[model samples]
Target: MNKRTDIISDHVISALGDGSEENFKKLLNNRSGITFHKSGKYSDNTLPLGAIEEELISQRVNGNRLPEGYTRFEKLCILSISEALKGIDIDITSEDTLLVLSTTKGNIDLIENPEMHHKLDLWYSANRIASYFRTKNTPKVISNACISGVSALLYAQWHLKEGNYNHAVVVGADIISKFVVSGFESFMSLSPDICKPFDMRRDGLTLGEAAATIVLSTERKGRVGIVKGATANDANHISGPSRTGEGLYQAIKHTLDDDRQIDFISAHGTATPYNDDMESKAFKRSGLESTTVNGFKAYVGHTLGAAGIVEVIYSVWSMYENMIIKTFGYDEFGVAEKINIADRNIKKELKNVLKTASGFGGCNAAILLKKNE
Candidate 1:
């Protein structure tokens, strides 16, 4: 028998907005958060990014009444979790509940600050966040690069299935800072304008800041259930995706669990030359090329650790509305592999949706979801 997990409540703090309802509305209206800003970090040059506005960030912390000593990333994490648990009946302090945090670089900017360097460990961040809820067990932190969010969710699924924890809250977050921006700049992997996923003329990806949370419980009270999930690492290359898409293919194939038909695919369309191509190859190999595929990176920019969790929440939104979100900047087919890309809003009965994410270090994770009917 397969263990079942339900996504009870979700919240997202992103460039688009705070709550999932607001963000989904904006997405349905074809709104984007990518913007241009003059930066002093990268040689005083103007860079187009998907950063959350300063005003929104300020309001989020102030409105939430977060602790005064918390850092920006900490405030974002706590705000997202608090919002997600708003009306849920789960007792956060119960020993039956678990907390999992997904982040690629926790306080990466602090590395440059001599005083902050002493507290940059990811475990420290996770412990601090969990302390707010007074959980019985120390929160688990997953730091598996860009796919960390999906990995964390998968871990929670297995943890709940193990008959140990009745409920698990998974949160992922990453913020754009000079430390992360300069590293991507060094690789010239950033797009100059809004990213165009699967577009023939696509240049590169744009980074965004976001924190998203999803609460999973073994009980079937939520509107969506996690059907299954899996992860695969081909180790094809240390910092590059497998050109053959083997890693991503295995991840998706396992998640499908013998179900050949998926209503839609929420892909990790980073808009880079190689990443998009690899995803197309994977989808085609998995016989999902005919499914309407959409990428959220164009709307929110590649939000690193938060990408998977935020996109999964958006996929649930699609299921809730029976609508397929248009690939924000996908204009024309550009990949060598032929795959159906959603360029316009699609109104259809969505039953099964697959969420996939791929990051540096050849890591790929995938999970399946079904609308709770």
Candidate 2:
């Protein structure tokens, strides 16, 4: 028999809130975490961002006292993982358990400080997180551009199905910093206002910071589980995505079975012209142009490495609530093909959902999730 892997428990700490359910509640209430910033902390230019307060981070984790030596990046991972573990009985130290860290730039904030170069290694951060939790296995680290989170989850699922481990703790995070902000600014991809996904007036993406963890176990079934997943790289450009949506189309085609219907799509709608256009073309080619779709970037901004996992967790919450949220900044449809962009919240049965992500280096991924019967 093939082992089944299911998402058991999860937690999210973003500008919106700390818990996964808490963030979902704020979304339902039409509260956005993205706010315009005047301070030159992250970037020299004033722009809107989904940033969490430093004081809040210091006071929210581990009874208001975080352990010593962990960077801000590490702190976010530990706090999120700790809270997620509260809902599950799986032992982190068990030999059958595995830990995985997903991030695009772990401790990249320390790049300017040459003396702190030791903390710049991604492996060091992953090892530190594993050591903090006393896990028996060396944690796996994935830094696959913006697809890190989804890649990590898919990787964990593969391991669980292969009987290499029974449980997998996957955490994806990236904190806002000068290095991160400047890079986007250079790309001219930082929006001055809240991001608008699939809107005619859409401009650029808003950057955000977050850490999200999802625990997957093969030992038992949960409310929802990943049914199929596939990744494809078009090798279109070093930093630009394929304009034809070739990679994403391939991923969606591979992930969906012939008879399965996708109720809605959690799109990688970054609000950029090329990305939104490419996604629309991909959905059209996959014969899903009319399927309802929504993007969470307007609420929490584009959360780098955490975007995939964060969006997936919110999708799960929507499935449980039996509702689909409107794209926050989306009003008029603007993509090349006609796709159903949710302009209003609709309550309905979301039995099967598709989550997709596209990133630089022409990477695209799709994951099909089903509500367990």
Candidate 3:
């Protein structure tokens, strides 16, 4: 047993709304933030996307206007971290505090534009965000494909347990760009309409953009905190996940250890045929085929690097509210394995919840959040 890493405060900025509560409220109402996009910004064809309005970003930030010279990506991160830091007692300037940034593509949209090549670097963007808050330490950045959010949280927890830092502000953000959209389009992975996770009509994933932040400390600052986390790679194809679900299962097995009684699971249900099927197989392999599971993608539209942190924040809200939100677009159990996918809101006591993520390069991550005793 190690010192527990507890979440202090958290925030989420998505198409649903600003704060975690706002987004959770929409979930309770079965409202989705996904919208149809016909703009030529992402692609030539119309696509479904979960993008935050520029006006919202510009208006909700600290100054009601984005700071000069800061890219949209940087501003979104700052806004999320700033909201999470509101009224908290943590001294971000203290050397005992660390900042960790998680994003698959940080300022990657600047690649095509000139005179900002340095801003294209993830570290540069991370430092900019940290400097905005006057943090003393050089920020750590994680860019592990789609699992960056969970990976960043795991890194913070490991360092906190080791007494390297007293507090860590982990923020994950990613915005959809022409470059990113075109890459996914090349693979034909984007859904033409709202995604259907684990549903028979599911075809492809809907891309999304968002920034989510979570503050963690060794002390119990909140009612829920991370208990354990693990990661495993199955050495599968670059874009395709393991069909047997061995990687995700191994990660789940290691994360749960002796405690297999998970109240529910926040799955990485991308709505793609392979991802949902693999996750189902993994749940079956872990003997958790009966645990209620739900995917947040239907609401947030697969927010790339932010998916892990965003979904984690939503899961925390579920624990606090003691309600499991339904899989938004799932009306049928379409996965190959017979897993219990939550199609309706479930009001049950949640003491422990499992959050799982799988990404490119055969990466899989699982983290357990337990109600503080």
Top candidate by lDDT: 3
After the best TM-score superposition of candidate 2, give how far the Cα of residue 339 lies from its true spot, in angstroms. 0.3
Question: Tens-digit lDDT track for model 1 on 114-213?
Answer: 9997568888888889987788888999988989999999999899999889999999999888888888888888888889999998999988989999
lDDT of 3: 0.91
* True-structure RMSD, every candidate: 1.2, 1.1, 1.1
In order of listing, the candidates' clash counts read 0, 0, 0
Q: Relative to the unseen true structure, what is the Cα RMSD of model 2? A: 1.1
Displacement of residue 109 (Cα, Å) in model 1 is 1.5
**2 against 3, candidate with superior lDDT:** 3
Task: Give candidate 2 regions above 4 Å deviation.
Answer: 62-65
Shift in Å, residue 60, candidate 1: 2.9
- lDDT per residue (tens digit) for residues 1-373 in model 3: 3887999899999999888889899999989998888868778988888999887887876564546878899999999998898878988889989899999989988888888888999999998988888999999999999888999999999999999998999999999899998998898887787899999889989989999999999854778999989999988777898989989999999999988899999999999989999999999999999999999998989898899999999999999989999999898789989999999999999999999999998999999999987
Clashes of 1: 0
Q: How close is candidate 2 to the true structure, as a TM-score?
A: 0.98
What local lDDT score does residue 224 receive in model 2, on the 0 to 100 scale? 93
lDDT of each: 0.89, 0.89, 0.91
- Against the true structure, what is each candidate's TM-score? 0.97, 0.98, 0.98
- List candidate 1 segments past 4 Å from native: none
